[model samples]
Target: MWCRIRRRTALPRKLKTVPTTTAPNSFPCSTAANCGKKVLDYAFQRGLMHPEDMGPMTHWYSPTPRVFLEHFKPEFMVQSSNNYDHPEQQVWDCDDEKNVEHYMELTRAHIKHYGKGELFHMIGLAEWVFGSPEENLATKIRVMKTFIRHLRREYPDAPLLIASWDFMFRWKAPEVRKLLAELDPADTVILDYTTDSGSYSNNFVNWNLPHHFPWIFGIFQAYEPQNDLFFNFDRAEEMYIPVQDDPMCRGMVIWSENSHSNPLLEYLAKRSVDEPFSLGQFCANHCGDRAAAMEGLWEIRINFSIFFRKST
Candidate 1:
């Protein structure tokens, strides 16, 4: 039997009334303007980005953040933590002064060349904690805390965006929550929730709404979740469909690596304003195998701008 796929409908032109409950409600959306700009404005007002220009189209190619910043001209920069092969090493082996200075040099270079007034969103990838099997939860917390504290001391003005997988619960699982609470909320925004199927399923089923932890509002959502490689929008829809009613989910970051390989980009491009109460494509970055073209794999992340009306 073929099952019918239910697609989301377009949002209203305006949210005349705020939602009073968890049921899906309609809101006014823009039609004559750019939806991307609208979303970016929201992100900026909420302090999601240091500057107002950042969007999904922002690219970060090696060498340095120069070309990426200059070309993409993103108002925000997300700096992820290094994934350590050996998890046991909490403290760096290199001298603190040298390592700190080294990082400062890189930051200074990026700032001096491409970013003068731009804001950075520093991220702590959850993979770093798993590096040490011998380390307990307490150790992990200590490590993250110290690292964040150091980053704050080094870059006093830059904002920090903490990247973490659900690990088990919200990544803000009790102990983790306590540790994060110690940090200033203005300086940190937790990028919780995940594109991983295992984590998504656990969190979705256990918690009535997709959001369980209050500290985490922003999310890193993968359009598709499979083999930790390919993200399928079909999969993402299946996982997210059940919880679209939750207002706590403020915004999301499309998994950059997965967005390029999927058909969702083209699909969204073809959608009309009458389509759904979802983001229409604002910015997109393509992703694929570096060496060879992979069949049926098109990775790209897009920021939906459902608020704007089309210009005739």
Candidate 2:
């Protein structure tokens, strides 16, 4: 039977105290313009933390250099198509005989550096394979399966997190579900988020995976170019209560494209860690009136942009 948290039940009022560290275990992942330092600065200035009081935190499994298949030896690069300008076309043949040894070697190096519980939280494999267009679904599944198996074999205790965009689930839910089931639930987590108007509940419940499958509900709170906020804070206020109450729902991740630092994001981060948190209180503490006004403007811009793009 699937587990569902009652809508009326209050979320637990418990907050884990932040550790004094050079980098908090949970910060925004580096994206286009938002580097780690800028994220830290935003947090610090907002009184979220003081850098001087911080210490070294545990390392997480981010593929070194943050490039796709870059960890593979130079010789391996020649075996695959290279399109440095376009990330989607930068995929290689997963079935290549030569790729197997490279994968094994890469996994070994990862295990050496981030084996066991060395990773502070979870290892991300989204960029490594999730959205790449190089391989077909069947090949992608095999590649992911092999990758997960190798990682689990070497670092049995580390939590592995894989991210997927809404399109993947919308078009290939069954295959994705099957692939996730193959991994050990205890060590795997699904970081599923939406780029448009989708809900975590929809993905979590509709996917119908085992209730034990760990998940982190991600919200793309902000985006680039216009630097506008996309999430409906009012909706989040109502929806997050039930989501947080769910046992399988590990927590929330607030993502932005080029800027991880935003007022709304800062507020969400505070709310996530603070006990006895109230959405109303959060709005009030920050400027509720201003937030409402900005949200309205953002809606107008976003709607216009969508309409304009579609018409064009």
Candidate 3:
């Protein structure tokens, strides 16, 4: 059934009109370890930054080990007695209405702290929270819907970014299509794709959903433990070119696991700020010549392969 979704027609080039409030570009360093500062430094040094770039503040999120969400609990609780010195000791059950309310409060606090400046809302990495062990599909979706509603009420002007994997294909349990269909397209932005899937593909965006929903293509380039298998620059170029040209695409996200990988970092930085699908320019800037750049890219691939081969 999910396979049929992959076969659906690609989204039309002339997508529905995007809201004027949409963000143009973002560099996500959430998964990268201690490298956020480094990425910012590099961007500043190269003059690749724009006043609108959210790379410096974008939060990387997953379901388990919800450190940020946990820490936010005590600080946002309305009841003074609910405060806990050790928030890590607290357990949040999504299935419970009271707990979910607390979660919403925490989300509000997060938005208040991070939501300011040009973007106006905190970028949330919220895919995993929708379906984890404690919450069933129905409960998770219900919680998310409620949370989004509250978010809209408190911060109507803020754009909501909901991060997810291949949601159309993977989230078929109780059928979230209808639930997602009901969301306001203008305020909702979906971040799709992952490094494991080799960046953006023709079927990356879920065409089955509303055409007006803003979509951001993700580019996961590096991981921890220094594996050699990374995003194929040539293939990445092929996949993202259409995305770059697509009107529906809000922007792209570049991520790494633990440490900053220069090759992938440079690739996305240039693509986001300098030019889209400009591999030649990227190579020229980094290697000083097209031939040298080609050689350098080849060397990175070879090194990646060798590193993985030995590790295995």
Question: Each candidate's lDDT (Cα)?
Answer: 0.37, 0.44, 0.45
User: Model 3 over residues 228-279: C-alpha lDDT tens digits?
Assistant: 3334566666566557556777877765654656767676777777455444
TM-score of 3: 0.53
**Which 10-residue window in model 2 sums to the lowest lDDT?**
50-59
Question: Candidate 1 versus the native: TM-score?
Answer: 0.43
TM-score: which candidate is best? 2
Candidate number that wins on TM-score, 1 or 3: 3
> lDDT tens digits, residues 1-312, model 2?
001111111211221121222235644332312343355446547755221100000012211122223433322212122223232223344446454444344333323322223332222222232333435444456666755565566556766666555334333556566666676777767765552334443454456532457877666544553353443455455555556556787767755655534655665676687545443454456666676665566567666666765686
- List the candidates' TM-scores in order: 0.43, 0.55, 0.53
Count residue pairs with overlapping backbones in model 1.
32
Give lDDT for model 2.
0.44
lDDT accuracy of residue 117 in candidate 3? 22
Question: What digit string (tens of lDDT, one per residue) describes model 1 on residues 101-127?
Answer: 333444443333223434444333233
Clashing pairs in 3: 33-258
